[model samples]
Target: MNKIFSLLTLLFMLIYLPSQANDFKAVYELAGRHFPWLKGKVDINPLENKKQGDAFTIEVVQNRLKIEATSTSAASRALDWYVKHYAHQSISHMGNQIKNVSKLPLTNGKISQSSFVPYRYALNYCTINYSFSFYTWEDWEKELDWMALNGVNIMLAPVGTEMVWYNTLIKLGYSDQEAKAFIPGPAYTAWWLMGNLEGWGGPISNEMMQQQVTLQKKILARMDELGIEPILQGFYGMVPHDLKKKIADADVIDQGNWVFTEFKRPGIIVPTNKQFENVADVYYDELKKLYGSDIKYFGGEPFHEGGKTAGVDVPKVAQAVQTSMQKHFPNSTWVLQGWQNNPSDKILAGLKKENTLIIELFGENTNNWERRKGYNQTSFIWSNVSNFGEKNGLYGRLQRFIDEVYRAKNSEFGSSLKGVGIIPEGINNNPLAYDLMLDLAWHAEKPNLDKWIEDYTVYRYGKRNPKVVAAWKEFIHTVYNSPVDENGKVLYQEGPSESVFCARPSLKVNPVSSWGTRKRFYDIERFKKAVAVFISASKDFKGSETFETDKVDFLRQVMSDKADLAYSNMVKAIEGKDQETIKSSSSRFIQMLKDQDELLQSNSYFTLNRWLNQATQFGKGLPDAKLAMYNAKAQITFWGPDNNPKTTLRDYAHKEWGGLLSSLYLDRWNLFVERALAGQTVPPAEFYQMEVEWSKKADLYKPAKSNKKNLARIQQDILK
Candidate 1:
């Protein structure tokens, strides 16, 4: 009997213990589907070692590159490894332009490398809303491919979660109308998930909601095949504010409003309540039915971003939530965003350290992981969120990222520091920042920045121009390498110091966003010199799209930075009642706007129409298309209902994109200049009114294309 039982156990192990598919079929299929350009050039095959973490071997034999890995994502990353190191290429979160070299670099033998991190991750809650709320399957395919290439094996994939919530709510004894009322629209779902506000940007069409579920199915399948782990939204006791009305016996807390506003937040279902288990069962049952049973990571923040925790035992409630998750998906990791005062100590005590992953969200501005002791010994990822709301700006503390990630890896809490991640609110700017952060996953120690950048410039523009290299070095010292004082206070403004041109007309121009400062942290003349150097190489690199794009961007900043000096003169003229001088200063400021618009139009990455068109196109053929356009415009602009001028959230997601600078910002400045000249009161009412009208329009604007010569001419004109 014992011999028979041993034989049966061995058979069971063979059937079940191999958790991973351990094949390149799925990966090869993904490559053929998404990046068909790489079909004949690259080939993937499985490595024999199944127990090892995602590792790969790359070799170029007879011009056919064979990549062997433990998994498909590993294989994909191996391809990226070759592209980045051998071919002198870069694929970043900001832009996707991999140079196709006709001649391949010769690889000696099989070159092997393994991931230092168990998990490489991406995205922020704001990222979903700011950048990807309008993503189609094609958009998602490209993004997932980029993620895999960047070695992002675990990502927050919460697309169509609103629909899941809607479906689950209906199953749990709620009417369809109640369910629809509970769900926020596409643009505002991120905050809704965070328990910030509920039902704000809604009246979501059924068509749109259904479309999301279908889209999510594809996203999940692709992610699974690519070896990228999809972190789904877990049940964390957030229910519709009207949950009590729908489920009479539901023990829910009425979290009043978010950020001292009249905006109602979703109700928190008390976790200790026996009803919590029942609701969770229903929720997870639906989750598994919709997505699948293979999910290994779950993300949900209880009492996120200042959500109320009154009348409950914090630790016990946390325990209950985790218990529910573990009960449904045994041994699954619970992911938490390490934002301000989040995943409180009391809550952390309740969680099992091994199963919890904390994302240190604001690594650019604050070192929460280091301060919080790695969330009291729970596993954490050091993340860099250099951009917010996909706001257009060229800024990042690159050296700080390298220093901190190295420190964390070598610190006393190094064992608990699991990985590095890029959690940008928007992932479209500062390509160098993302590449450097992700590169941390490969190196055990700090990479020589000077040497790394030399290679980066080569990959960025195909060949190294001495002037271009000097410019980048200057950028690294001035913008990317910000100085910090004692107590970790950076001697720099937060979130891309607002350009004076983008600010509301005032004698004293403060930052556009509340937490931001108008202080110019770096030397303006030094930054200008860097831009001049880059433009000088435009003749040599005129054919390179990457070079031209970056050149135009540099010129745009040069024009924007000069606006402060012009604004200062304008203020002096206004104070002296000198109409002629005021007109002259105002004319210069207006000219700067025109130049910026033209420069930005030269690249799709910098164009305002890219964002607006994507948002509007999402609501195409729907009755509420106009409403969708309004939501998109409002998110990037006023960011609140017109009733609240004093709302702090307004302008938090502001962008200085091309069309916006040309239209909305220009109109505001034009009105301000006229009022100042006429000695009329310049209240914000007219500008606000104009903004509302602008948001209502759905007209498309084509981005004007300009060549490198044109860009260089413009740069010279601006600088001169």
Candidate 2:
């Protein structure tokens, strides 16, 4: 019997060995190919499986990572350590919830430190934006794979909604010319759908619209495979301003003037109107034809962004929109955004309690979360929209703000709150913010934040020293926890609104603004010590390819801040006519720009052409004299040329840089003209030859290096 058992065990081992080897090999290849930094350094440990009927358990471990997992699960138990150690309290709380629901088991141990994950799957509003238009398929695929690995189940897939609109407009007897005007350019889809702006960058091709629909279909198909739910746009009575021309008798509420333009604002066809109902039917029918009729939820708002709702009873209008929706699709829920005093009582008063859901946006700062209680007694989800307009390299809602939201939601009012969500206008900017936000969705309770951050450092860096951990903790408390004065009101700097130009009107008056002002609120001496420690810890990692990219990005931000503070102090000294101060400030500015240039050059694919154009226009040349005047004109013409109201330091810098570029080029041009007039013969027929060459070279703007790939690899490795 003993001999027979030994033989059986040997046979079982033979069968399992290859499968384990293959899995590890595939993981290894993925890490090595995508994450070049982990080339030969990542330690891979084969998982040991224990089977019980159809279900099986797998054990995996590396330095700090000790996790137990189920065979059929999408994510591993290793993720729990990342959530518990690296994520904010709110995020960790959400992660805990996911663990309970999935019934995944975890062991107490650290994991190799790296970035969070390599990719993210983002689902913006329907009829607004799709991945293909803004990002490459390679980018999207990587993000989707990462989403799957991270256990993202429900995604807001709003592709092909444009097709629904296109078909609806065509059926309504509107010509192609009229229909094209309603659709915006590729870059402005988000704002167009939100009704904040329109037709600024477009005259979109019908082919492009169709292409978006096709791409959306593919996205939905992939999402379905990954168990992600797609949110479709529902009929909310939105109509172009030209709709009145098509239907003279149609009852429509004037939406007022278009934002950032003098054009007539689009009208909201009253859902009570028979014409409106007819249009909605055609719209839904076309959508069903494309994506099927199985969609249970529809995301559309009666008063989106800041559109007017004149000549319509708010309650009546709300009832009509819901009634029209239910007629075609029963039990359909209207997902509304609780943004800036919207979905007023009149709208919510008539809607059925069970069939409506609201996303309470801007929950981090505004008590609108508490005061409105989600438009007064409606089931809502607490969502934080971290960055606005998807600006790159910006931060998100602070850790404490997240903590407060968690505490509030779990308190007496927790019943109304369904779950937590991240609703950023753009998703590609901050990876840490995205991961941390998602982590909160599954957790039921918060963790000790200081300890959690320490764990995150270990997981991100592979090996964490006390100094590195201390630096991060200080960053969380100071820069991440700084206060802001908005419109004379003091508030915690959290969410996208706090970081962008629209959020900082005073930046024109104060160029540096609040970049490093956090030091004033904390112990500068201690913070400097922490910063020094962090810098020292990272010094040896200069060429360690295994370094976490996101951490590197964070470090860049830290260094940038130091540079900015140093420059600001020097500028003050210059004002005082102190030679020492002038030298110090100039040195700091040059060094900061140099370091930034170096960091940007690290990645070969960095593209800063667009920014360069804006910066040049704002800061360089003879044309610069006309900038302030032009800027004011542009602002009045179309909301400051960028359709943004709140001007930023960057914007000011753009103006300044444009002046500089113009002056330099013009001076060079003048010098060439002088030489030509002095009878200096050259190959070119005219003195302007040099100017042409310079123009061509200067026009080809190049951006700094980006560490996106490195960051992604680090994140994925840490999660693993």
Alpha-carbon TM-score of each model against the true structure = 0.93, 0.68
lDDT by residue (173-237, candidate 2, tens digit) is: 88887777786655445555666555644565665566567667777766565445566778888
Global local distance difference test of model 2? 0.51
Q: Each model's C-alpha lDDT?
A: 0.79, 0.51
Tell me the tens digit of each residue's lDDT in model 1 across 483-541. Answer: 77778676644567676666656666676766666666678789888888877887887
Best by lDDT: 1
Clashing pairs in 1: none
lDDT of 1: 0.79
